[model samples]
Target: MTLYYDETGDTKLPFESLSIAETVIQGTLRYLESPYDAEVNLLLTMNNEIREINQEHRNIDKATDVLSFPAIDFEVPGDFSDVSTFDLNPETKELILGDIVISKEKVLSQGDEYGHSPLREYAFLIVHSVLHLVGYDHMEEDEKETMERIQKAIMEYLKISR
Candidate 1:
């Protein structure tokens, strides 16, 4: 799996953000039983940049902790049964999973607000965003419960705590 990460501005992450991102992504893929190698793009940005992206992409006009843009639209959430050859990257053959954009400012604040280390909160958000890349959503109760369960399992798999 390849995680393409780019950080904009200097929000100063509280931890080795790339390492944590890689570990959580790997754990998430394993927990979901995804057979194909994948590629995920991650962007770490500050409040102003995140707000612009949120407005441009989601029309929210506000900053958010994280935002996910999935490459594949699975017929069934977290099920790769429908993946086709065309979904693979031409050269590497890695599935184009999706992109995740996070606001570093929110990570620190949320961590303090929730009484956890910034590392834990950052890992949680990445896990949540990865779930979205794999077609998970929380718009409904059952979906929310299922996603929560999967997230908890992945967090445990990574041994990350809040």
Candidate 2:
């Protein structure tokens, strides 16, 4: 897996303690023993820029901790049973997963609220977004529970605990 990251935000604040944006591109190359080869891009932008994106895309004036844009449709493939395994890219050797957008301001605020470090919150957001990229959703109670369980497992695997 290849993870690509970009950050945009206020430089005045401590660089180590600011907002971040992470974009993950999954292809066929496996970095971890997971089913997908992924690339992650992280961007740290100012609160105003995040707010603009929120208003433009989500039409919500308030800032959010994370925003996810999934490239693939969630409808189970007809050959789902036949193809028990995921497909891989022959060229890139990856899965071409999707993208994830997050807000640093929200991370900081939520971290404080949850009594955890910002880094942990940020890792959680990334894990959550990656799960969404791979056809995970929490539209229902059961789905939410399942997704949360998966997220926790991934975080634990990565040693990112709260």
Candidate 3:
């Protein structure tokens, strides 16, 4: 798993704390623990750029915190009993996960609203986006709860307490 990340836009926003372009390529590879190669690319941009991206991809003009573009269309099993088990991609020996786009401006603003550090909020967004790349959705109440639980667990594991 290779996470390729890049960032664009102002680095000096009043509300912005940490504007970074981080790629968790090696960490993602280790987490997946599969012979398959999963590449996860992310572009963290400001609100204006994000708005353009959202319009181009999702046909929505509004800026969203995060957006995921998955390579595969398989649905994860409803049972969360085996969430630790990583999926494998047999063909290319790589899962070829997908891409994530986040808005730094959104993160900072949301952090203030949620009463948490910008780092914690950013971490949450990363975890949330990664989970989506791995086929997690929260359209339903139960699914939302499950996803939130998983996100919190990952955050705790990373020692990112709010």
lDDT of each: 0.92, 0.59, 0.67
Off by over 4 Å in 2: 11-33, 76-91
Query: Model 2: per-residue lDDT, tens digit, 1-162?
Result: 545555677533223432232321221112123554444445556677777878998899977777776555545421122222244445666655555667778777888999988777877787777667657788999889988887776666666678
lDDT of 1 by residue, 1-162 (tens): 899999998679868999889888988888899998889999999999999999999899989999999999988998988999988999999999989999999999999999999999999999999999989999999999999998998899889877
Whole-model alpha-carbon lDDT for candidate 3: 0.67
Write the candidate numbers in order of decreasing lDDT.
1, 3, 2
Tens digit of per-residue lDDT, candidate 3, span 30-121: 44343445666778789988899899998999989989886665455222223322443454455566788888888889989999977777
TM-score of 3: 0.75
Question: How does residue 22 of candidate 2 score in lDDT?
Answer: 30
> Which wins on lDDT, candidate 2 or candidate 3?
3
Candidate whose TM-score is highest: 1
Worst 10 residues of 2 by lDDT: 23-32
Better of 1 and 3 by lDDT: 1
How much RMSD separates candidate 1 from the native structure? 0.8
Candidate 1: C-alpha lDDT: 0.92
User: What shift in Å separates residue 2 of candidate 3 from its native position after superposition?
Assistant: 2.2
lDDT of 2 at 161: 71
